[model samples]
Structure formats: C-alpha cells, structure tokens
Target: MKKYLLLTNEELKRTAKPYLIVVAVLMLLEFILTAAITKMHEGKIETFMRENGVSMQEAIDAYGKSSFAQVVASGPFLLILGAGMMVILISAFVIWYRDWFGKTNYIYRLLLLPGSRSSIYFAKLTTIVLLMFGFVAIQWLMFFVLAPLHDLLLPPELFERVSIAAVLERSGLMYLYDFYLPNFALIYLFALLLIVFIFTLVLIERSYRKGKKVIRIFLQFVILGAVYGATLLVINSDHLFANEKGMLFLAFTFLYLAFLVIIGLRTVSKKITV
Candidate 1:
C-alpha cells in the first residue's frame, strides 16, 4: 500500500508538472484579457452615454443588446481555458502510452515492482483523476479571485458580479457537473467509466503484437459494439421498463465498467509486453 501510494504520487508529479504550467499560463492570460476587455467595453458605453447626453441606465440598456455585450457576457477568455482542458484530456492517453513506449521503457520497471500489477493501473488512474480535480479546483478558485479583482478595478455598476456557478452554467460545463455542485459524484463516475474504457482498449492493444494484431483489433471492436448494443437495447426498452431509462443507463454503464476493469487487469497482469 505504501509503495502504491508512493508510485501514484511520483506519477502525479511527473504528469502534472508540464500540464499545470500550461494551465497556469493560459489561466493568467484569460484573467487579464477578460478583465481588460470587459473594462474597455464599460468605458466605451460610458463615453457614448456622456457624448449623447443619455442616462446611464439607457446607455446600459442599449449596450446590453449589442454584439459586444454578447461577447462580454459569454467571455471569450473561456476559449483559452477550454483549449487547455482539451490538451489535458489528450494527455491522459499520452501519459499511459509514453510509459510503455518511451526511451526508458518505464512500464518494465513498473511491472517488476514487488506488488500487484493492478497497482500500476490504479496509480496511473489516480494520477489522471487527481490532475482533473486539480484543474477544476484551480478554475473554481480563479473565478473567486477574478471576481473580486474585477470589482476593485471597475466601477460597481459597470461590473456585474458572476459567480463560478453562473460562469460554468454559461460555458455548458455545469451540465457535465450535473448543474448542482453536490452532484460531483455523477461526474466522478462518468469520468471513471471513460478512463476504464480507454484503459481496456490500451490493454487490448498491448496484449497482442504483429501476427494476430488485426484479429485482436477486430475482437476489440466486436466487444465494444456488443456493449453499445446492450446499452441501446436497455435504452430503447424504456417503455417496457416503465420509463426508468436513466436508471437503466446508469446500471448498464456500471456493469460495463466492471467488465472492462476485469479484462484490463487480466491483460495487464498476464499478457502485456514491455
């Protein structure tokens, strides 16, 4: 257990360092740009109101209906943040692949550890999950930090305060987080299932080499297709099951996760090559 924890911590540090640096740089840029652009738009509105002899409320109402207003409301700064997230998602696969295929062949050392082979799988999985939550925590903290900074830099009336929840809602991430803060369990489960599926595929490829590679790849597709077909059958039978489709889907996903995890562990322990 201690060794597993140590391995996980080491992997987390190795995987997170570069990713965190990129995330931090992008986050800082987004913060500065969001604040600068928002303040600029507010200043333009104020100048227009002063020049036209219109009231502050009237100026605000007019600007609110403009294209610039939409941009400000949606916050283009999030685009950089979103791109960073996509990079992290792709890195998840790279993290696993590089261990096996890198110059060091780290997977050979990892497999030779005096513990269960599943520990390697779990350690990498934990590293990825930790990085994901770390990103989310940083994003949440940024919202709080940027909100107050904006308030201090801009006038109270011009700066409309938006909470992290509101920003996430607008960005469509809240739905993934299940719209409510406490629903993070759903997010965790969904993320775990995805990671498990990916790991299963990785194991399948690792378990075979040149001779039967095409057949092994075909078998993987067949397995995946069967899982998908089963899921669809459950979903389409919603009417027969009294419209409990959501529950049925969740149950099916959990069952598939278990099946994949078992297969992945077996392959990693017995068939995977260094």
Candidate 2:
C-alpha cells in the first residue's frame, strides 16, 4: 500500500509542472476574457445610449443585458474550454507513451520497480484521475470567482447578475458536472469507465507484439468492442423485463471495470517486456 502511494505520487510529480501551467494559463485567459467581454459590451451599451439619447435601462432593453452565462456561451470561451480538454486528451496518451519514447526508456525502470507491477498501473490511473478532477474542481470554483468579476465591472442595473448556482444552472456544463450529489457520482463514474477503457487499450497494445499486425489490431478492436457491447446490452435490456435497469447497468459497470483492471495488471506484470 505504501508502495502504491509512492508510485502514485511519483507519477503525479512527473506531470505536475505541465498540469499547473495548463491550469494557470486557462484561468488567467478566462479572467482576462471575462474582463474584455464586459468592457466590450459595456461600451456597446454606452454607445447605443449616447447615439439614441436613451437611458441605461432603455439601452439594455434595446440591446439585451449581458450575463455570465452568456459570456461562457460565446465561441471564444468555449474554445478556451476546448483547449483544456485538448490537454487532457493528449495527457491520456502522453502519460504512458512518454515513458517509452522519451530520451531514455523510462518504462524499463518503471516496470522493474520493487513492488507488484499493478502498483504502476494503478499509479498512472490515479494520477490521471487526480489531475482531471483537480482541473474540474478548480474550474467549478472559477464560476464563483468570475461571477464577482462580472458584477464588479458593471453595475447591478447594467449587469444581468445571477447567483453562482443560477449561472451554473443556465450553463451547459451543468449537465456533465451536476451540482446534485447523485448525478455527480453517476457522471464521474462514467468518466472513470472511459479513462479505464482507454488505459486498457493502451496496455493491450503495449503488451502484445508477436501476432500479425492486422490481426492484432483487429483483435484489439474486438476485445474493446466486447467491453462496450456488454455494457450496452445490459443498459438496453429493460425491454426484457429486467427488475431495475439502472441498478443492472451500474452493477455491470463495476464488473466490467474489474475485468479490465485484471487484464491490465496481467499485461503489465507478465506480458510487457522491459
């Protein structure tokens, strides 16, 4: 257990700099963006009121009030969000591939580490989860941070101010990262399944090499397909008069995760060569 923690911590340490850079860059960019967007809209309102000789309220009525939710919905803001996701997607591979393809083959050292090789696998998986969830937690809090910034730039009368909760409620991200406890668990559970699925694919590819290339690729697809196929069948089996489809789906998910983890551990321990 101590070894696992050490491995996890070591894995996290490797990516710490880049992770922090990405988080800081995104937050800074969003902060600047929030201010710029506020300034631009405020200017528009001022211009319209001056040109037409109207009151601030009248100008807002004519042009509509700006809200934090609207700012987030803009193309530029969504692009920033996409940039964060892009880093995560690249990380999914970089975390493992770099160890093999880096200046020296770090994989040799990692696999030979003094403990169950499963520790290495779990360490990498845990690092990915922690990095991802850290970004999410900070980004969630960013709404509150930006809310005041939004209100600070414009007066209450000019700004369409809403509670942080209301801002999230109106935003699309609320669907994925729900404020409600139950849905939050379900959403993150599926997210973990996705990361595990990706890890399984990478591990399987790294472990086997003797077979014909085409055949190996085909088999990889087939095995991955089985994971998804079983999952879908369970979820869609309600027409067969299953007692509780949700519970069945959740149960099958846990079983499938175990199966994949077992495969990954065996691959790491026995199949992979230094």
The true-structure Cα RMSD of candidate 1 reads: 3.6
Model 2 regions lying over 4 Å from their true place: 210-243
Q: Which portions of model 1 show Cα errors greater than 4 Å?
A: 43-56, 65-75, 176-182, 210-226, 236-243
What's the count of clashing pairs in each model shown? 0, 0
The sequence of per-residue lDDT tens digits that candidate 1 reaches over residues 1-274 is: 7777988988977876787788779788867876787677778888989999998788877775222223324646657667766766766677779987777888878888897988888887788777777777777677667667666666655656666566666666674446454356556677777777777777777778876766876776798789879888868863656446756766777787888889889988999987
lDDT of 2 by residue, 1-274 (tens): 9889998998899899989999999999999999999889999999999999999989999988889887887788879987887787678778888898888899998877787888888889899888878888888889889978988998777788776666666666776678677667667787787778677777767877657435755775787688769877767864745546666666777777787788778888888765
The TM-score values for the models, in the order shown, are 0.81, 0.87
Cα deviation of 185, candidate 2, in Å: 2.0
Q: Residue 244 of candidate 2: its Cα lDDT?
A: 69
Worst ten-residue run, lDDT, model 2? Answer: 208-217
